[model samples]
Target: MRRPVLATLIAAAAASALLAGCGAPAAGDAASAAGTEPGSATTPAVAGEITVLAAASLTEAFTTLGRQFEAAHPGASITFSFGPSSGLATQITEGAPVDVFASASTATMDDVVAAGAAAAPAVFADNVMEIAVPASNPAGVTALADLARPEVKVALCQPAVPCGAGAASVLAAAGLTVTPVTLEADVKATLTKVVLGEVDAGVVYATDVLAAGDTVTGIEIPADVNAATSYPIASLAASKNPHLAKAFVDYVLSGDGASVLTAAGFRRP
Candidate 1:
């Protein structure tokens, strides 16, 4: 009787131990399942697609920066819509789905801000007006005054665009009044007219001339009469991914972005 009772007690003790072991996983297994130990530092995942509305003048530089930004933030992507800043601002006000807004002029950005579509913007860069002519130099445009020649078929951006405003300011300062053969919607279009030889010359941003490379020749504008346009960037208030939108804006203001902008002939703000 004593031996039977002792065997029963031993079996009960073994069963209890087995049950306790089954209640919890091994330490290594627990750590592996969690993918991190307690108190460990982990980076938050940044993954999403953002749409950026940028000025036509930023086409080259922003495209390069967008690629670099995607490379840095794995699983993140950027889509760009490039056009006149005024047009973009209008779109944003009308409920366009844009994550970021980068304008070539503060006035254009101000309109977005006034519409409550964007927050207070930060100036990212500045650009000055330059005269772009066909490589053939059809009108023999060598100076700013050459654009004022009656025979020169000059293409200028529409008055609503930043490039046009800058051109107007510069012309006003130089005390020159000459009608343009064509008024383009944006700087890129103005540059295109010169590239296609449709116009003798076009007033465009300095960066636009650099972006054209050998396609067009750039004539420097004298500092005394030249006008600079400020580029401002902001995260739209209606952004679906607000955090990512702000991050992209920060990236543009970062040192790496500055290097890219400088390489494309933009002046740092």
Candidate 2:
């Protein structure tokens, strides 16, 4: 009887050991199944998409900055909407799903702020007007005065845009008034007219001229007569991704982003 009882006890112990071996995972298996290494510190994932509405003048610089921002914050993406600052402001006011707004002029940003579409906007950069002419300079436009030539076809941004207002100010400061053949919607459109030879000359932002490279020749406007437009950036109040929007605004104001903008001919504000 004692022998039989001992054998039964040994059999029970063996069965319990087999169950334990089957239930427990092998070393490192637990971590692998959990999608992390053993003893590794966990980090919060940074992921989301934010849409930004920016002025046309900021196209090149902002595009570069947006790429850098995405690289720095893995899993984050940015979609940009570029147009005249005034048009962008109106879009935001009309309930556009924009996470951020970067304007070519403070006045345009003020409009968004006044409409409760954006919060306190910070001036990020400044840009001045430059005379953009075709590479061939068909109308022989070499200075601000040259744009007044009767035969010269000049293009200027619409008055509703910051570029247009700046152009008006520069022309006013020079005491010169010349009718434009076309009123473009934005600085890029004005530059395009000059680049495509649709117009002999255009008044556009200095940055736009720089972005055009050799496609268009830029005649520097006299500092005294040139109108400097202050660029302001802010996260919109209607942002779906408020945190990501604010992060993008902060990134734009960072040193790395400033370096990119400065390289693109934007002056530090």
Candidate 3:
């Protein structure tokens, strides 16, 4: 018989189990059900932990995903180290205890693949760039072209990040050069500038704006600019819980994960 359920928030923790040398591939999928191990019952506390190093832009969606994973598989703990994809890659190369590395840019993951720190990575979701403006619209910025004005204080991520690269593409396609007041290390930082009213305008992923929940208004850039963004995830070479890692990664591409990402305004890759 199924045990009585508790007050689990679904996105709270992760479930870890011991089943060496068995089961299906869970790479790039983050959603796994309880009893993933052989003969394992849906126990209240399976007791396992998986560490994930992800890009800064994925902070919200992944956090939601984490909570869901924890709820589905009770007794599991998921720890995340979210930051710029490049920084995460460097940490992995330097031998961090990272079971999964989800990069905002393929180039960053290439570094991990080059150093043999992670297995083959896969692109899971795609994001499009948008104009993030203050909730009050103090600058009167309405369109992508408006960002070219002198009075608009803009912000963009450092060029090493995926969102930054996409921002450059958008500017070049429109033949516009924005003198951003700040070049943040990650997309989330850039978005924060607009949300905090520190900048009149900024560029960020469409998903970022949605995740912010009305803290900022988003204007669609161009479809071509959207063409350049992608999110890739992989399993690290040094993992104590690889089976669980794969389960999480695989969940990322499943229908449940796709729905969460879509609701957050990210497109399927």
Candidate 3 has what TM-score? 0.81
Ordered by lDDT, highest first, the candidates read: 1, 2, 3
The CA root-mean-square deviation of candidate 3, after full C-alpha superposition on the true structure, stands at 14.2
lDDT of 3 at 224: 57
Say which prediction, candidate 2 or candidate 3, comes out ahead on lDDT.
2
Sorted on TM-score, best first, the list reads: 1, 2, 3
Clashing pairs in 1: none
Instruction: Report the C-alpha lDDT of model 3 over 182-206, residue by residue, as the tens digit.
Output: 9999988998899899999989888
User: For model 2, what is the C-alpha lDDT against the true structure?
Assistant: 0.90
Please give the lDDT score for candidate 1: 0.92
Q: In model 2, what is the error at residue 229, expressed in angstroms?
A: 0.5
Model 1, 1-269: lDDT tens digits are: 36698899999999999998998877766765665454442423456989999999999999999999999988788999999999999999999899999999999999999998887799999999999999999779999998788999999999999999999999999999979999999999999999999999999999999999999999999999999999999999888888678889999999999999999999998
Candidate lDDT scores, in order, read 0.92, 0.90, 0.83
Model 3: CA > 4 A from native: 1-47, 225-227
Model 2, position 38, has a per-residue lDDT of: 60
lDDT of 2 by residue, 7-33 (tens): 999999999999989999875777667
